[model samples]
Structures are given as C-alpha cells and as structure tokens.
Target: MFEIGDKIVYPMHGAGTIKAIEEKELAGQTQEYYVINMKIGDMQVMIPASKIVSSCIRPITDIRALKQLIHNFHHGESDEVLPWKQRYKVNSEKIKTGEIQDCAEVVRDLLRMNKEKTLNSSEKKMLDHAYKFLNSELESIKGITDNQIKSFS
Candidate 1:
C-alpha cells in the first residue's frame, strides 16, 4: 500500500511518484487507483490498486545499493555473445523485473554491443527504451548520475 508521494518503479516504464489515489467507477465497480506521475516523460499513469502486486510495482532503490551496483556494473564484462533472438529475450526479462541492477546490466550490455557493431532496428529500439528506463531510475535516486552514465562510456 503506497501512500501519496511514494516513489515506485513500474516495470519497463521507469520510476514514477504516486501523486494520488482516486476511486473511480469502472464496469459498475468503484475501485481505487494509483495515479503515478512518471519522472522522465512527464507522463501520468493510473494503475488499479488491487492489481498493484501483480503489476510488479516496486519502491525506488536506495542510493547506497545503487552506487554499489554501479561500481560492480562498471567492472563487469558484457561479452556473452548470444544470438540476437536469445539476447533480446534475456534483456526483455531483465527489464520486466523492474530491478535497477538488472536494468543497468541491460543498458551496459546493449551499449557494449552497439559499440562493437551497429545494432539492428529492433535491438536499437530496445536499447533506446532500456536506456530510458535506466536513466529514469538513476534520476530517481537522489545525488547520483555520472558514474552510471560513465560506465557505458
């Protein structure tokens, strides 16, 4: 049960703040909904309160753990060399987890792959989306930025 102003990450959609909890009638049912204002896109999303658990919403990560993950990610390798199809599946799964650490790896791996060879259209789109998610989460974590961005550089 997140209160108003609680920061949360919606899988594949990045981090957002709970702006309001409103009740609306839909299909003759007055159910509570969470109104989330997304950080990066300046967008708002409304999710049903009852479905929050299955929706994979999670609280924003702590600065300390985020820093540790950034450090480890910077030193980690990204040369598994899987075929494109398999790689896409793996990355998709990570993004679906809504975990900042996993999102960081997807960003790092895709960036590495991009450097070695130009990514195909689909992978390019995926990288762009993944980067947005990664950056949005990074922005959500107060007083942290450059290290994570620097890792891909």
Candidate 2:
C-alpha cells in the first residue's frame, strides 16, 4: 500500500524510501514489487506487494509515538542481570527482527547496563547500531538534527 517516495522502516534494515513500483515476470507470472532504497546507506530492496504486510515494513513513528519511545528509554525498568552471552543473544535477535519497540528495549537495557559497567566491544557495537537506527527515525519524525536527538540520550 506504499507509494513511490514514501519513507518506510524495513526491519533490521533501518529506514528506506520507496523508489519505484514495477511489474516484473517471476515464475512465469507477472508480479508487482516495491523497490526500496535505504536511507542510511546505499542499498536497494525489492519487496513483493503481497508480502508487504507480513514483512513488518512500516512508516516512521509520529512525534507522540517517538516521545513515548523516548520516555520508555528514560524510564523503562532494567533487565535482570544475566550472563553477557545470553543477553547478547536476546538483544541480537531483537535487532535483527527490526521491531522498533523491541529495539528500543534493547537500547534501554544496554544503556542501563553501560551505566553500571563497561560493555564488551560487541555489545558496544550493537548499542551503537541500535542507537543509530532509532535516532534516524526519531530525527526524521521530529524534524530535528541528530544532535538534538542525542541530547535525549
């Protein structure tokens, strides 16, 4: 249901712009696909229309929703202390699945952990990636600079 030029978030892939809609022959049948060009990097993705809904692709959050996420980041409870390996596994899956709320949870959890102790290199990278992805959408939604968003950190 997305039109050309619409901005959408692709799970794990961050935000992207719908570059075009085209029909192509596949498996002896013609099908339509949305060509999405990533906003954060140089990459294009083709998604079948039928699969769009199931794919979890969605528009950027509104200001209110973004604020709620920020509030969650600021006030959310911490995860119980777990083995780093196990925590990394859970957080990694949340990032890969590209669910915004889940990613927020990971960010909140990691931030809390970082506040308590130093994170391993891998954990630091995951935290950075999650921050980048969330910050991009939040900046766009608020029409603010990345620095402004960083002030919320």
Candidate 3:
C-alpha cells in the first residue's frame, strides 16, 4: 500500500503522487481512496484501495531498473513484424501494463518504425502517448527537466 507523498504510476495515465487518502461513500458503501495528483496535464485521479491491484497502480521505478531500461533502448532492436492491426493491439496492451520497460519497448519500436517510414496516424499517436508516459516517470525518478529528456532519446 502507498502512503501520502509516495509517487506512483497509474497505467496509461502517467505518474503522480499520493496527495491524500480519503474515505468517501459511493454506491452505498464507504471506501478508502488514494487521491493522486498527476505530474502531467495538471490532473488528479482517485483510485480505490480495494481496486488498487486490478487498477495497476504501482510505485515509481528504482534507478537500477531505469538504467537497465536505458540500456535496452540503446542496444536492443525491435522485431515487430505483425500487421498494423495486430501490432497496434499488441503495443496497446504493453502500454496498458504501465511497466516502464514495456512502455520503452513500444516507444523504441515505434520510433524505429518512424525512421524507416512514416507511421500511420494511429501509430504516431500511440507513440506519442507511450513516450509521454515513459518520459513522465523518468522525469520524476531522474529529476530531469523536459529539455534533458530529449538527450536520452
């Protein structure tokens, strides 16, 4: 369980801090919720304690994992050969997992594809979203500004 001030990444929504934990009544039940203040978009999200597991809320990654992710991006190659429809489905699933490594893979593959050729509009949008999600987490963990993030790419 996360305490107030703990940073966490909400799947597909980017990273945020636990600003407060509050009890509220909904559907004739009183339940505890984590009030997350998102780092991007000036947004806030309230996730229920009971649903935390299924909601895929997770703590920010450690430095070791971040280093490994950067290594993979620099040294790995993507073998995404599925048709566009199938590839989109798979990439979407990976991004939804909210795993930084998986999200990085999606961004790497999409960026690679873009270099080879222009991606369809949908794929471009997906790439942007995945990159934003991954970069937001990286910024929080690494304490880097947006300008510094580009140097990693």
Candidate 4:
C-alpha cells in the first residue's frame, strides 16, 4: 500500500508523490483515497485507494530498470507498415498501461516513424503526450537527467 511521500506513476497522467491519504464521503459512501502531488503539470489527483491496482498506479521504476528500458528502446524496431489508425489505437492502449517500457516504446516508435514521414496531427499530439509522460517519470528517478531522457529518442 502507498503512503504519504511515496512516489508513483499514474498511467497516462505521469508521475507524482503521494502527499496525503484521507477518507472522504461521496454518493453516501466513505472511501479512502490517495492525494498525489503530480510531478508534471503541477497538478494533483485523488485516486481511490481500492482502485489502485486496477488503475495501474505503480511505483517509479528504478535506475537499473530504466537503463534496461533505454537499451531496449535503442535496439527495438517499430511496425512502420501498420496503418495510422491501427497504430494509433495500439499506441494509445500502451500509454494507458502506465508501464514505463510500454510508454517508452510508444515514444520511440512514434519518433522513428516521424523521422521517416510526417505524422498527422493526432499522432503528433500522442507523441507529445507520451514523451512528456515518459520524461516526467524519468525525471523522478534520482540520477537521471533531461539529456539522458532525450538520448532515448
């Protein structure tokens, strides 16, 4: 279970530190929720404590894991032949998973595709969001820097 001061990643929204855990009443029911101070966007989110697992809220990946992810990103190949619509759908789902590796793949694949051909506006926006989400989490890692994050691209 997460507590105040624990750092976590909320899928699609980016990473944050748990600032508080409180019980609140809504719809005549009282439930515990985690108040996260998001690292990006300077925002806060109140996530239902019971839904933590289902929502894909997870701890920040360690530096070692992140290094491995970066290595995979550099070596992996994207499915460039997939139609844009199909590719969009797949990438969107990956971003929703809140997994660092999946998010990195979305950023890497979209970037590689953009280098070959221009991505339509929708894909361009997705790339921006994915890149920001991945970078925000990377920033939370102790020794990583924006330069290292950019090198993944």
- For each candidate, what TM-score against the reference? 0.91, 0.86, 0.92, 0.93
Q: How many backbone clashes does candidate 2 have?
A: 1
What is residue 125's positional error in candidate 1, in angstroms?
1.1
lDDT of 4 by residue, 1-153 (tens): 998999899998999999999999999999999999997789999989999999989999888787788788999877667888999999999999999999999999998889989999999999999999988898898788777778876
Q: Please, what are the lDDT tens digits per residue for candidate 2 over residues 1-153?
A: 899988788887788889999999998989999999886666899999999999989987766666676677778787788899999998988987776677888888988889989999999999988987776566556465566477456
Ten residues in sequence with the least summed lDDT for candidate 1: 144-153
What is the lDDT of every predicted structure here?
Answer: 0.86, 0.81, 0.88, 0.90
Q: Listing every candidate in turn, what is its Cα RMSD in Å to the true structure after a full C-alpha superposition? A: 1.7, 2.1, 1.8, 1.4
- Local error of candidate 1 at 139, Å? 0.5
The candidate scoring highest on TM-score is: 4
Which 10-residue window of candidate 3 scores lowest in summed lDDT?
Answer: 143-152
lDDT for each residue of candidate 3 in 64-120, tens digit (9 for 90 to 100): 675577778878888648899999999999999999889999999998899999999
Which residue pairs clash within candidate 2? Answer: 12-98
Query: Candidate 2: minimum summed lDDT over ten consecutive residues — where?
Result: 139-148
